[model samples]
Target: MELRQLRYFVAIVDHGSLSRAARVLHIAQPALTQQVQQLEEELGAQLLHRSAQGVMSTDAGKTFYEHAQAILKQVEDARSAVAQSSDKPAGTVALGIPQSVSSALALPLLTAVREAYPEITLQLTEELSGTLIEQLKSGRINLAVLFDDGQLGAFASMPLVEEEMMFITRAGSQFAPKKKSIPLSRAVELPLILPGLQHGVRPRIENIVRAEGLSIGNVIDINSVAILKSALLADLGATILPVAPLLSEIEHGQMTAYPITGASISRTVTLCSSRNIPLTNAGHAVQRLVVSVASRLCVSGYWLGAKSLAKSESA
Candidate 1:
């Protein structure tokens, strides 16, 4: 079908009415209606119907709309690629990041992409692991950095970095501020908040606590790592979270990370893209930035206590 016709069809679907889409497109309503009718005829299905309300898609229309949106996006990307100068990826790269991943990686990734690939536009969607997995399958994202590493049967993934998880508490708390990093025995005393049970993190935490045969008197469950950080900063709870998740706040002294010495647990973060399709240049550039920056940030924060101690001893 003609690109213009597909564009008109998409516009009607978006605006939910002939008149509104016509106004948006700077076309007359009758012309817009005729274009949609033609598109439907070519497809051999009734694409939309009208009532006292605005237009809505039929089942076939909905099916076609999905493909149509993808086609239009591809067409736009092609046009941009042809028009732009060499050595630039002039299309949008949608990135899916879990919230915990974002707290660990967003700033450095964004900065590096801007510096390295100026023509590539990035759209970031942050959700938890489960939601991001669905989105990755649905083509909602071009690439993703995820905390979940196993049972990914179809996606192509690489070790972005393996972050050693840290058990953390607030500075003023009795648990964290001491001559040394808090040992595992003192872990159960403070109130605790952690990412909800869906993540790989929670299972490892449960394993650790059980293995130690330690029980916490006050525990909180949260879905977002940012909320976990907020809770820790406020001294509301302690968290056993990934170093990447707490890197920024830990550096600023808003929170503290004590290495989990009684037991060792680390979550492997993966850079994933569609297995069937290799990443475009733009996509790979984004992936590179995220992997590089995440490693630097986490590595720097990983030795935080030791770094502080060395500095103090030297001083």
Candidate 2:
């Protein structure tokens, strides 16, 4: 019921033991246990499953934990926003980046944030676009660079870039396309390694193919960008993705990126934040920096096949 009770419950869930949480919180074990009991009584549901080894969240507790974390983060953000100075904002800002976009934008954003806001702590999480959306909704991350999948009504977004998807394969692989680009029909016929349906790119590709009455024939589902790249290098199969993730390999002649012709196979990348959640000063600063970095990269031709939608500005 109380903020302290929420904190105590969260701590217990995190440490998975009452005693450990008590030690970390510098409170008596009995007091912590009592607080958790009070919280459970007020909520009218058992929140934790106690065992000899440790404690675990029940189904109700799991749901409550997500809400509690979001509430706590919002409270912290409120405090930070009220106390932050306009000239030197100081707080922690968590930003989620999709794996494909991270290769081009992560380091640059990090450097820009560090140089401009030394006092602000920047936490970068690289995840699938689906996972990033979930994290943003749950308040685990303050901002996200996500692909616009026509399902972004819940978030306030700023257009960053429109990235072209390419069909990629190992340079010397037998399956490599001879031309600079290939039709969607021809590309899908190759043994393709792609992410599952939940990923941003896979669904877009599927939708476009379906519109043309084309179905992907041979396919392997791979979610990890690292493993996907490995599969391409080992010639397991080709993949259709943005060129950024494999830019280095393509430039080195280890991989070939062929633009997917006969289709507008592209995704618009956006800087997204939850519509219901107001950003802290640090979060706002980082959001601006992200847009700036993306614009700079696109203008400098560093982020290949990306057209900037936002104008360049100083972070």
Candidate 3:
């Protein structure tokens, strides 16, 4: 099968509908279907199964999916290598960013990449830290900005920045009412709308709370930052969030930022890529741009400390 057929199949998997994939690829739906079917037949397998809900991979389809994606990526990489001989970046770079990183770094990163590498296309996905890491292992994203959580052994990690999380409550709420800062112990005394134990942040937050012999109340165990933020906005309870997650609300006076006192809450955000995949010229360029923009943001805004900012400029 042709490389274009592989691309069409990948697009169909991404969009879950031939018509939708056709629209995205700017090809006629019938033509897209024909390409995919031809490719499937050539491989002697059914690459996709359709249902009322959407298209999904069969067992054989799943196996072919991995190999097909790798072939397409290698083809793109070959093109990129050739393009790099001319000192220009072109083609697409798949990026997976955690929601928190997207909040802080995505806009500046995208803007700079757009300005500097006009020919580059960025295919993007935003997910939780866990999901982003999984995608990295699966070769779905060329680069990812997410939490380390001590679980990224398959990838090389460059620490990007560390964000100090804050314990925030609704204005005038009984918990953390307009305090400049409160000890982690005091912050945990109130109802908590934090992530459940399975979340990377939950254990650390809970450890600090449990130490003071006071249990977290109203334990809502929220998973989504948006849901947690909404709970805080409604004065339901407090949640620990990095500066990025609540920056807009805090800036707009809809929410508050109460830095945890005595003991600070923080996490290291990292830039990671698969160790097995060689970094393409475009990937390196984008990584540099991400560091540059993040450093400027940190230095200009006083959002991160000097020690943490060291990695912002490094590869």
Q: What is the number of backbone collisions in each predicted candidate, taken in the order shown?
A: 0, 0, 0
Error of 1 at 182 (Å): 4.2
Question: Tens-digit lDDT track for model 2 on 149-196?
Answer: 899999999999999999999998888887878999999899999988
* Model 1 per-residue lDDT tens digits across residues 137-214: 656577876654457767987666655677777776655646455566676677778777776667666766778888
Sort the candidates on lDDT, descending order. 2, 3, 1
The residue-level lDDT of candidate 1 at 5 comes to 91
lDDT of 1 at 52: 72
**Native-to-model Cα distance after best TM-score fit, residue 192 in candidate 1, in Å:** 2.1
User: Candidate 3: deviation at residue 61, Å?
Assistant: 4.6
lDDT string, candidate 3, 104-183, tens digits = 77777788889988887877788776777766776767888866667778788787777778877776666665558877
Highest lDDT scorer: 2
Error of 1 at 311 (Å): 29
Model 3 misplacement above 4 A: 1-5, 14-47, 50-67, 196-200, 203-218, 302-307, 311-315
